[model samples]
Target: RVGEGVRGKVAVREGNGGRVLMMLATWPTEVSGDVVQSVDTLLAGVRPLPEPSVAVRATPRAPEPEPGDPR
Candidate 1:
């Protein structure tokens, strides 16, 4: 899932042998032709994950709000 304030595009598709292929692209600022180029560059260097897969998990911790008298 995309986070708030983030700018990007993502796509997911099923690959051969029931594997899932995910593509995520993020631009630091805004989406444009340059962002497409960035995505291409990132994809070019990607390698498939090794077999006997390992799962990575994390629990998101909420960011602390700035000091204020009101919530």
Candidate 2:
């Protein structure tokens, strides 16, 4: 798990009887995208975090009227 300023590794087992070894590392926010991409590319062959799949969800919110315009 990623925290404020530390990084480490953990062993994880999958429900399908597969084992995945991972190295967890945290990077400072100041790090550039290129560096991150490089690291991702290097680790592409390794099995990634298996338990939790990364997801992005958008929540619907009330629409706001445009500035200087009548609703």
Candidate 3:
């Protein structure tokens, strides 16, 4: 239990490579509407963006002419 207003139970177990996996399967608690609102506000519209495009070069550009030289 985190506090008087919130009570939760978490189950943690070891996975492959000694990694811990925590599961909050059952967390029945009594919280005010304000608490729920605050949590929603904190994670409002949270999402993952698509990966960016990457440019590839197969050749170098030609050198530019000098200021006083002809093209």
Task: Estimate TM-scores for all models.
Answer: 0.37, 0.37, 0.31
Can you write out model 1's per-residue Cα lDDT over 1-71, one digit (the tens) per residue? 25665666666656556787888776655567777787777766555555543343355567777799355
lDDT of 3 at 6: 65
Candidate 1, after superposition: displacement of residue 43 in Å?
6.6
The alpha-carbon lDDT assigned to residue 59 of candidate 1 equals 55
Which scores greater on TM-score, model 1 or model 3? 1
Q: What order do you get sorting by lDDT, best first?
A: 1, 2, 3
Total backbone collisions, model 3: 0
Cα lDDT tens digits for candidate 3, 1-71? 66654654455555444555555422236756666555555444333344344443245568999899878
Superposed on all Cα atoms, model 3 deviates from the true structure by an RMSD in Å of 10.8
TM-score: model 2 vs. ground truth: 0.37
Better of 2 and 3 by TM-score: 2
lDDT of 1 at 71: 50
Give the winner by lDDT: 1 or 3. Answer: 1
TM-score of 3: 0.31
Name the lDDT of candidate 3.
0.52
Alpha-carbon RMSD, each predicted model: 13.4, 14.6, 10.8
